[model samples]
Target: MTRQRYRQLRYPLIALALILGLLAIHQYRLYASPVTAQRVQTVTISNAGFLPNKLSVNKGETVSLMIVNTDIRPHNLVIRELNVQSSDLKPNQSATLQFLAEQEGQFPFISNTPGYPEIGYQGTLIVN
Candidate 1:
């Protein structure tokens, strides 16, 4: 190729090579990282409180808790031990709380919404 033609193609060739190198690095990282299977648990919220209030899981497992609100007012769920909290969900709305169950013990979760009795809206997560 002529010198002028080479100059015109140089920048674009460098950019293409950089883009390909980044993509190859990303693919390598995706494959080299460890993969953990997630465990899903559904908790329904109502005036009566959380259904199936007790949840059990193994230590080091990831948990995806789907909280569905079927009540007339908004509410949120909180797990103090795991530092997990859900957004205020309106009627017929839902939110998900995900975290790694790293500790082996019983963690309590509850709805802190006003006017709801703490005793009535409480549950436990048992990790073994």
Candidate 2:
């Protein structure tokens, strides 16, 4: 190859190598960084029922579930695994509950409001 053509090719190859090396270093840094799994999720309650009866989150993450009672009657949200329980959510009222998803499994929730068995309140939280 001509001297000028070889020089031009060599410069481009060197630039490509540098770019690839930088990308690899960046990726390594990202992987080596501390990974703390934390997340927040919102849930709404309406006249019909819970907007999302089932929620999915990553293990070791904390979730903040916002419950907005849009119904006339009171309702409650209970998660046994997280030991979280709330009651007396009157109509147009809102409440917030926090819990950490340390277990990797499915947990159930219920309203626990009396005379609401027929209406039935049930949900699940899945962690993985």
Candidate 3:
């Protein structure tokens, strides 16, 4: 091809190459990265304890445990086996615990602070 003709085509080719390169990278990331389905569950804490005493989820899912503290005292929720816990939540406050449910079993969560779990600040997590 003539020099002028080649010059006219060079930038377009470079641009096309760049676009293809970006698309390839995007495709690689889309498939290579692990896919996680985000799950959000809400449990309320009152004088009685966790609103829903029973919680269930499937394996390989990331769970967002949204805790709404609606009691007169502070409470902390924890699932020791799952390595998930929450900070002390004052009355009417809320906290979120995000964790990956990697194992399949029944995990029990209780209040980390004393006198709470025994008083009913507890629940069960069934992972299937």
Which residue pairs show backbone clashes in model 2?
Answer: none
Summing lDDT over every window of 10 consecutive residues in candidate 3, give the lowest-scoring window: 112-121
Clashes per candidate (backbone, < 3 Å): 0, 0, 0
> Tens digit of lDDT per residue, candidate 3, span 1-128?
89999999999999999999999999999999866547679999999889898998988887878999998988889898878889988999998887778999999999866644556778999999
- Measured on C-alpha atoms, candidate 2 has an lDDT of 0.78
Give candidate 1 misplaced runs (Cα > 4 Å). 32-37, 115-117
Highest TM-score against the true fold, candidate = 1
> If the candidates were sorted by their lDDT against the true structure, best first, what order would they fall in?
1, 3, 2
RMSD per candidate (Å) reads: 2.0, 10.4, 4.1
lDDT of 1 at 103: 88
Candidate 1 lDDT tens digits, 19-120: 999999999999997555475799999889898799999998878899999989888889877899998889999987778888899999899877454657
Can you write out model 2's per-residue Cα lDDT over 1-128, one digit (the tens) per residue? 89999988998999999999999999999999755435456667777677798999888776778888887888878886679887668888888787677789998877877734426577888889
Evaluated against the true structure, the overall lDDT of model 1 is 0.87
Query: How does residue 108 of candidate 3 score in lDDT?
Result: 94
TM-score of each: 0.88, 0.63, 0.70
